[model samples]
Target: MADPTTATPASGKPGHRRRRVRDLRAMPGFTTTAWITIVTLYLPILVLVAFSFNENRSVVLWTGFSLDWYAKALENDGIRNAAWVSVKVALFATVISTIVATMAALATTRTKKFAGQGLVFGIINQPLMIPEIVTAIATLSLFALVKKITGLSGIGYLMLAHAAFCIPFAYMPIRARLETMTLTLEQAAADLYAPPLKVFTLVTLPLLGPGIVAGAMLAFVVSLDDVIITLMIAGPGETTLPIYILGAIRRGITPEINAVSTILVAVSVLLVILLFVVQRRMQR
Candidate 1:
């Protein structure tokens, strides 16, 4: 007997019923909403990039396209100094954060479940969970105390503060990579009578290299663009590029400011692309 649920329509040749499945993409206004969201997010950035090439002093006024602003930004001593400072801080922060994050990832992932493991993870990621303003304020108080007690002050303070916050950013990628890796290879190396240190040097380190690089790149970008923490930790004559940009904006937005911002955006985008490429290769 033919079941009613399987009954065919009048035009159907067989009793097979075709269900009408609705696709999310076919939903009303889905495409329009997606386009609107993308435009809203990126249009301002497009405008900023466009004005970076403007020849006129006015940022909004349309003028002939020129590279004069970029050239001026390069020649400006303040900009150059600030850029140098940013690079130095970012490098130090990247190194410190990457090393600490790598070690923390290995410790947490390679061991058996134990007491306080979740607590350890929480401590490592505390900075990320807390607001940047809170971290800045706490860092300021600590540094102020150290300065009062030891009277020691320099770019080192900024480097340490940046590294402290960058650790969680660096930790995430390394931990994810470690979790995805299988233990088979490491176990085989152990079966060959290889020392733990030798096995790690030849096997584990090579496999983990891409994640380490990705984490370092991410940490570098975070430290480079840091404003609030740097502002709080930096001493006199220790301005970074972001701080310099803040000063410039306060004075007035200029073509030079736009040019510098565009350059910064370019660097950040390039690093992020490289990080993505490395991770994709690691997946294979």
Candidate 2:
């Protein structure tokens, strides 16, 4: 009548039962499959980073290690200008998206649930759910109409496009932070006759800082690396780093291009690390 799974071993002690544990590592080919997947995903990245340090002009050929390509990429005026443009656009987009996302998160999390709340969430996350190409095409069409009406052309278009798509990226973390927060402190402030505005600025905003920062970093990274949206929205003379890299690739791959890509990968990794740290702090 004893359970088979929890039955005691024949040679073991009478009072203790040995439970069966599912060992994924013991499965046939599990280790090999995992290793293959890891290597397949990361081998190209490893190759790219390695070749960035190669002294050879050819990306595939192995030569002596050198920093010459990195130097060349930095010294290139086109790359410098494109990098500057990317920074400006990313900064603008991050600020705009973060502010809007924070406000939206506050409104949704602080109030009573209303009808159409699910629809509102769906609308907010529409860009993330839809294909990037579709968003890019739709943004292009919208911006084209605005440009025609206003007779305007500038980097502002690209900034707005990036911000529009980045809103959901910024919103998710802020909303998650707000949801995990306890109502005790805010209720205490209310009981003490603190106005809602004062409670938010003095109590809520400080508590929400980590989420805001994480969201901003995420938005900044998304805006920085956006190729499809940037390509569709960029005006004449508004080339960004990704676009620059694309042009360079069309010409041919070189160590300089590899160096630039490696730098971008490094930057993205750094920002993601910082974001992880902030999220950990929020958990504490």
Candidate 3:
């Protein structure tokens, strides 16, 4: 074992890196630590999924395996309504956030450096820096004021809140893609007398499409998983799936929640796979 109390001498040999790589398997407790970490992270999810198929009502006690809970989860009107609301909010938020973020990414990446560029970047990424509860409370206050002024309280407020919060999540991937992209194609189009709008739509946008899709997927997942902000801004009839899950959890744990959770996890995994596939194809 390497000395814990004393500083180890640094290796200056050319073959030192390969030797370290070969010795990684010999490190004390390496395999045990990795197995423990994996079990700690994934064991609960596997247990939940297993119990979700239990024929018995008790979530903790597993009986014979069955699919009744999934059927129940599907048939529950409250669950259906909440799931629909979540889907709607996620779709709208993803669309609006992706569009706005795409434009913002282009502006930040394409334009010459300006005096306020740093400030603009900071503002765009404020949500990532600040605690979400702070943003939620602030958004709630703003919504209340707006509602008072206009006497309106619809699901649009929920959509707007999600879109506002997800902007940074969507912006980052798009900006990264734009940064890595070469300007040769766009420059060639410009030299041939193509207008800026035409160049963006015909050339840049196609190349950026995968990144836009990835950003939209990320924003959608974030909005779907968000609880605090949705709870704060949600009206009586605008409950999303996360809000519904929170209420259900407060009441008690049930196999119904496990079924719903398993379904959501499956869908999320599928979307992630799709996002990766799209990005890989684009790279090819």
Highest lDDT among the candidates is held by which one?
1
TM-score of every candidate relative to the true structure:
0.92, 0.92, 0.89
Q: Write the per-residue lDDT of candidate 1 for residues 123-181, one digit (tens) a residue.
A: 99999898899899999999999999999989899999999999999999999999999
Reference-based lDDT, each prediction: 0.92, 0.91, 0.91
Q: Indicate which candidate wins on TM-score.
A: 2
Badly placed stretches (over 4 Å) of model 1 are: 1-25
- The window of 10 residues in a row where model 2 has the poorest summed lDDT is 16-25
TM-score of 2: 0.92
User: How would you encode candidate 2's per-residue C-alpha lDDT over 75-182 as one tens digit per residue?
Assistant: 999999999999999999999999999999998998999999999999999999999999889989999999899998888889888899999999999999999998
Ranking by lDDT: 1, 2, 3
Task: State the lDDT of candidate 3 residue by residue for 48-125, as single tens digits.
Answer: 889989999997787799999999999999999999999999999999999999999999999889999999999999
For model 3, give the 10-residue run with minimal summed lDDT: 1-10
